[model samples]
Target: MAKLVQFDRLGGPEVLTLRDVEVRAPGAGEVRIRVDAIGLNRAEIMYREGSYFDRPVFPSMLGYEAAGVVEAVGEGVDGLAEGDPVAVVPAFLQSAYGTYGDHVVVPAAAVVPRPAGIGPVPAAAVWMAYITAYGPLVEAGQVRPGDHVLITAASSSVGLAAIQTARHIGAIPIATTRGAAKRQRLLDAGAAHVIVTDDEDLPARVKEITGGAGVRLAFDPVAGPGVEAIAQGIAPGGTLVVYGALDPRPTPLPNAHSYPALTSRTYTLFEITKDPERLRRAVAFVNAGLASGSFTPVVDRTFDLGDIVEAHRYMQAGDQVGKIVVTVTHDAASD
Candidate 1:
C-alpha cells in the first residue's frame, strides 16, 4: 500500500485528501517511483476545480511532476534499475498518471535520470516549467540571438524558465507582471526587462524597451482580452504563442485581422511531450543546459506533503514568485 493524494469531488484545495491504497507492481514498460518531492502547479488547482482539459474522475489523483528513487522496473524497461535517482517528466496526463503521492508507478519513458548534484526538490521542479518554456521559445518560435521575447506572468515558474531559456539562446527577455512587487525578483531570475502591466502601458513600454522594433516573440499563458494589448506589443511578422488560459474571458486576436503579418499560434506542453522526436530534442537541450549550469529551477517555497492543502491554497493565492514544492517524509511509505 502507498500514500497517495486523492480528491473525490472537485471544488477547491479542501478537496484534496491523503489515503493509503494498495500499490500495484510495475507492468510492462512501467516503473515504480518512491516520490520524495512533488512540484505544485496552477494546473493542479484547475484540475481540482474541474476546469482542466481532462475532467477528474472521482477519487482521482492529479499531478504530473516529481523526483524520487526508482524502486522497481518492469518488463522491457531499459537503462533503469532499482535505487536510481530520477525525475518524473510531465510527459503524461495528470488524470492518467498522477505523481501526487509518496509511492507512484509511471511509464519508464517518462522518467529521466536525475542529474548528479540535483536534489529531489529542484529536480521535481525542473521538467514541467523548463519543458513548457522550451517548446514554444526554442522549438516552435525558433527565437534567435539578440531577439526580444516577451514573457507574460513573469513571476511564474514557467515564466522564469522562459527568461533563462531565452537568455540561454542570447535572446532578450522582457517579462510582464500584473504588479510591481515582483520586478526585482524577475530581473534576478534573468529577465532582461520587467514590465508592470498594472502601472505601465504594455505595448508602449515594450516599444520603448525595444526601440520601436517591439518584441520578436511573445510567450503568454493568460489568453483573453488582454491578448489584444500583448498583440499590440509585438513587432510586425513576429510570433505570439499562447500556452494557457488563465483568464476565462474571450481572447481577441487583433493581429489576425487588424495587424500586419503578425502570427499567432496556440500551444500546449503536450506539443513536445507527445512527440517522440520533439521530446528527445527537448530532453537533450534541457539536459545540456542543466549540465552547463545555464538552467536551474527557482523554488519559491516548500511545504510538507501533509501540508498539501496549504500548498494548493498558496498556489491559488498567486503570491509566490516561482515554483512551490512539496516534500514527502515517507513515514507513510510503509503503509
Candidate 2:
C-alpha cells in the first residue's frame, strides 16, 4: 500500500488527510515514480481554499511538481526505465496521478531528466516557479539587451528567477517589495536596484532609477489597486503583464487618458500552455537554463510527508524567503 495525502472536501488545511491505497501499475505511455521531494507553491494553498481557477473533485490528491526515481515503466514509454532519476514538469495531472503520494503515474512528456550536479530537493523545486517566470520575461515580454525591467513581489521564488533572467538578457533588473528587510537580500540575489515601496514612493523611485525614462516592462504578480500604481510607472508605450492575483479585489484599469498608448494584460499558465508547440518550447527553454545554471531554485523550508499540516501553517504565515518543499524521506543535511 502507498501512503498518500488526500483531501475530501474543500476548506482549510484541516481538509487534507493521509491514507493508504493500492498502488496500481502504469498503463501504456505512463511511468510510475517513487517520490523523493515535492515542491510547494501558493497555488496549492488556493486549491485548498477552493479559490483556484482549477477545481478538483472530492477526495483529490494535491501536488503539481516533484523529483523522484522511476519505479516502473509501462509499454510505449521511451528514454526512461526503472530507477532513473527525473523531475516532473508543471503539467497538471488527474487526481489519480497527483505528486503528493509515495507513488504516482505520469505521462512520459511530463517528466524531464534532472540536470547534472543538482540535488533532488532543488531539482524538485525548479519547474513551476522558474517556468512561470521564464514564459513571461523571455517569451512574452521579449526582454532584450539594455531594456529596463521592473519586477514586483521581488522576494518570491519566481521573482528571484525573473531577476536572474533579466540579468542574462542584459536588461537592468529593478525590483520592489513592501519593506526594507529584504532590500539587501534582493540586491545580493542579482537585482541591480531594490526599492522598498513602503519606505519610498514607488513610481518616483522607479523614475529616478531609470533616469526619468520609466521602465519599459513591468512583471507583476500582485494585482488590484497596486495595478494602477504600477501602470503609472511604466513608460508611455510600456506593457504590464499580471500573472497572479495575490489580492482578491478587482484590478483597477490603467488610466487611458493619462497614457493613451500604454497597454496591459493579465497572464496565466493556462494561456501559455494552450498550444502544444508553445508548451514544448517553454519546457525546453527551462531545461536548458537548468543545464547551464542560469536559473536556480531556492528552498526556504522543507516538511516531511507527515508534517503537511505544519507546512500549510508556515505557508499561511507569509514569511517564507523561498520555495517551500516536502520530502518523502528525511535528509539531515536539508537544514
Candidate 3:
C-alpha cells in the first residue's frame, strides 16, 4: 500500500486528507514511480478551492510535479527501466496521475530523466516554473537584450524563474512584491529593480525604471483590481501575459480598454503541451539552462509527507520566497 493525498470536497488546506492506497502495476505506456519529493504549486491551492480552470471530481488527487525513481515500466515503454531517476513534468491530468503520493503512475512521455548531481528536491522544483516562464518570455515574447520585463508576485517560484530567464537573455528584470520584505531577496536573485507594490505605485515605478517608455513585457500571476496597475506599466504595443489568478476577484480590463493597441493575453502551460514542436523547444531550453547553471531552482522550505496540511497552510500564507516541496521517504534506492 502507498500513501496518497486526496480531498473529498472543495475548500481550504484542512480539506486535504492522507490515506493509504493500493499500488498497482503501470498500464501500457505508463511508468510507476517511487516518489521522493513533490513540488507544491499555487494551482493546486486554487484547484482545492474549486476556482481553477480544471474542475476536480470528488475524492480528487491533487498534484502536478514530482521527482522519483522508476520502479516499474509498463509494456511498450522504451528507454526507461527500474531504478532510473526521473522528474515527472506537469503534462498529465491531475485527476488521473497526481504526484502527491508515495508512488504514482504517470504517462511515460511526461517523465524526463533527472540531470546528474541534481537531487530529487531540486528536480521536482524545475519543470513547472522554468517551462512556464520560458514559453511566454523567451519563445513567444522574443525577449532580447535591453528589453525591460516586469514580473509580479516576484517572490514565487515562477516569478523568480522569469527574473532569471530575463537576466539570462540579457533583458532587465523588474520584480514586484506586495511589500518591502522580499525586495533585497529579489535583487539578490538577479532582479535589476524591485517594486514594493504596497509602498510604491507599480506604473510610476515601472515608468521611472524604463525611462517613461514603460516595460516591454509584464508577467503577472495576480489578476484582480491591481491588474489595471500592471497593464498601465506596459509599453505601447507591449504584451501583458497573465498566467495565474492568485487573487479571487475578477480581473478588470480598464487599461485594455484605454490602451487599445497593447497586447493582453492569457498564458497556460496546457497550450505548450498541445504543441509537440514547441514542447520540444521549451524542454531543450530549460535543460540547457539548468545544465549551464544559468537557472537555479529556489526551494524556500521543505516539509515531510506527514506535514502536508502544514505545507499547504504555509503556501497559503504567501510569504515564501521560492518553491515549497514535500519530501517522501521510500525503501527503494534513489538514483
Best by lDDT: 1
lDDT of 1: 0.91
Residue 258 in candidate 1, Cα distance off native in Å: 3.0
TM-score of each: 0.97, 0.93, 0.96
lDDT of 3 by residue, 275-324 (tens): 76787788888888888899999999999998999999999999999999
Off by over 4 Å in 3: 254-257, 331-335
Best by TM-score: 1
lDDT of 1 at 256: 57
Off by over 4 Å in 2: 93-96, 272-274, 330-335
| Global lDDT scores for all candidate models | 0.91, 0.82, 0.90
Query: How many residue pairs in model 1 have overlapping backbones?
Result: 0
What is the C-alpha lDDT profile of model 2 across 1-335, one tens digit per residue? 67778898888888888788888898998889988898888888888788888788877888888898898999999899888999887676434457886788877767877777877799888877777777877888888888889999988888888887888778999999898998998998899999899899888888899898888899999898888778777988888989898999998888777653677988776555545577778778877777877777778889998988888888877787778889897344531
